[model samples]
Target: MPSLTNQDWKDLEDSIKAAALTLGYDEAVWDGNGVLEVEGKDWEELTEEQQKAAEILGMDEDDWDEDDEGLRYEDVDWNKLLPEVKDAAINFGYTEETWEGDGEIEVEDKDWDELTDSEKAAALVLGYTEDTWED
Candidate 1:
């Protein structure tokens, strides 16, 4: 791919932010250091039934911390989840292909700076961080 100019990078970042917002994310920001920070609804933000379901799936209270950047349905260990929780996750639009052991949850085998805009945005939405891309 051709190198992206600064303006192109800016536009790409803007698009990512727009996508996040359209998807109902609470916050999205590119830190100008190869990291796109995103925050979504935390566990506490979920309904009581949702919290109970998460708990039944082995998630703890600490897992719901706002500082943890909220849960990513794709990162759940399907094999470990209660059958009902798995059903709920699937019903919520998470595919079995997104199960934790199905593939890497974080980007790998590429330098952070080398990632395309779409890749960065996808990783960000999945809760990846700057430390996740460290060599």
Candidate 2:
């Protein structure tokens, strides 16, 4: 994995934390050892999408070590992982508004490709599209 800038690290942390929370974890903490410690949920009980999110974060249920307090991962491409995490979050009641705050005009004037994933999520949640947003 490439060295993460502070902001990049924060974004990745926030994304995973959000996913964990949506999937019934009470808390998600990075252990400073390339592992994320998640509390308040069992790995076997996660929904398929939630499991997918966990896998994206490098937590493989099949190889989970019962003796460890955290799950390990390496070389994670956070860009690819984020969408899956966001999808899991969305299914569990998180919305773009949850990340971007409540507003009707946030998506306005931004082209579809220029919008961040959260913005696109907001647009979709609000029933708007590339063409329809201008209506």
Worst lDDT window (10 residues) for model 1? 28-37
Give candidate 1 regions above 4 Å deviation: 1-39, 66-111, 122-127
The true-versus-predicted C-alpha distance at residue 70 of model 1, in Å, is 14
Report lDDT per candidate.
Answer: 0.44, 0.45
lDDT by residue for model 2 (1-87), tens: 113211233456776656555544432223122223332247776667777766655667654333322112112232332454445
* TM-score to true structure, per model: 0.31, 0.28
List model 1 lDDT by residue over 1-135, tens digit each: 011112232455554445433423323222112222222357567666555544543355576443543234333345645465455445433456755546543435667687677666655544455555452
Backbone collision tally, model 2: 0
Query: Where is model 2 poorest over a 10-residue stretch in terms of lDDT?
Result: 68-77
Clashing residue pairs in candidate 1 are: none
